[model samples]
Target: MSGFDPRPLLGKALDQMGELITTTDDSQRDLPTPCADYTVSQLIDHIQAVVRRIGAVLSGQPFWSVPQSIESTDWPADWAEGRAATDAVLADDAILTREVQVPWGQSDGAAAAASYIGELAVHAWDLAAATGRSERLDPELAAAALPAYRAKVPAEPRGGDIPFGPVVEIGDDAGPYEKVVAWTGRDPQFAA
Candidate 1:
C-alpha cells in the first residue's frame, strides 16, 4: 500500500457500505446475515463502529475505546456522523504519512485504511444478501479489496480469533466480489 493513496478507494467503499446501512429498514433488523454471528442490525452496527474506530485511529485515539456494537434505528444519521469523522481527519494527505499504532500493530495510516477496505467490501455484500438487495452491490469495490484480503488472511487455519470459516468453494462463474468474501471464510451462496 506504500505510495498508494487509499483515501479515494476507501471513501468509495465506505459510501457503498453506508448506502447498505441506510437502506436497511428496522423490519429487517432481526434477519440473519451471511455472518452467522450477527443479525442484520448487528452487522450494521459493526460497520458504523468500524468507521468510527478508523477515525479514532486516524486522530491518535485508542481505537479500542470505541464500542464494538450499537443498536440504532436511525442508521443514516449515525452513518453520517461516522463518515464525517473519517472525512474530516483524512482530508489532509499528511495524516497518511503518520506512524499510527493500531490494535493490529504499528503501521502508517495508509496501510490501516487499505486493510479495512476489504472488510467493508465483504460486509457490504452481507448487508445486501441479508436485505434482499444483492443487485445493488458494487463488484468493483470487492475486486479492489481482494488483493488485500489475500495478503492478510490465509486460506486455512480458521477459527476462534481468526473470524473466518474455511473458504467455501465457488464455481468458475462466481464474480470477483464473491471470491473476496469467500476468501474471508464466507460462503458465496449464503442463504440467510
Candidate 2:
C-alpha cells in the first residue's frame, strides 16, 4: 500500500465507467444489478451522484444534504457528464490536497482521494456485473480501503445477525486485482 496514489484509482474508475457505458447496449439497459434496489441505469446514476458529491466536498462545499431529485431517464448521459466534471475537479492540484468535510466523515485531501478510490472500485464491480464485464480493482487501494470499510460496517445487527454473506476467498496464487474484485462482491467471470 506504500506506493498507492488515490487519484489514479479514481481516474481508473472513471475510465472503467466510460468503458462500461460505451459498451452497454440498449438490451442490457434495464438489467438488474448487485446493488440491492438499483437497476444498471440507477446504479450508474447513483455512482455519478457520489462522485459529484465528492467533488463538492473537495471544493469545500456541502454536498447532497439537499437531496436533489434526479430522473431515472437521465442516468446515462448525466452520469458520464458528472464523472467528467469530477475528473476535472480531481485534476486540479488545489483540490487534490485540500482539506474538506464529507457527510460520511471528516477527512483530509488524502482521505477524500482514498474514499473515491474505494467507492469507484466497488461501484465498478456493480457496473461490471450488470453489464457482463470482467473488471478488477487495484489491490493496494483495496487493502487501504478494508479497514475504512470495516469501520463503517453497520453496528445495528439486524436480527442478531450481520447482513452479509461469507467472505469470498482468493487463492494465494491469485492476483491482487482478482482479490480486490472478489472482496468487493464481483464475479470476475462476468463477460462484457
**Candidate 1: how many backbone clashes?**
0
lDDT of 2 by residue, 113-155 (tens): 7777667666666777677674443456556556655565443
TM-score against native, each model: 0.94, 0.71
Encode model 1's per-residue lDDT on 69-161: one tens digit a residue.
756668999899889988998897876878776766787888887777887889899989888888898888898899877877778789976
Clashing pairs in 2: 132-191, 132-192
For candidate 1, give the lDDT: 0.84
Scored by lDDT, the top model is 1
Top model by TM-score, which number? 1
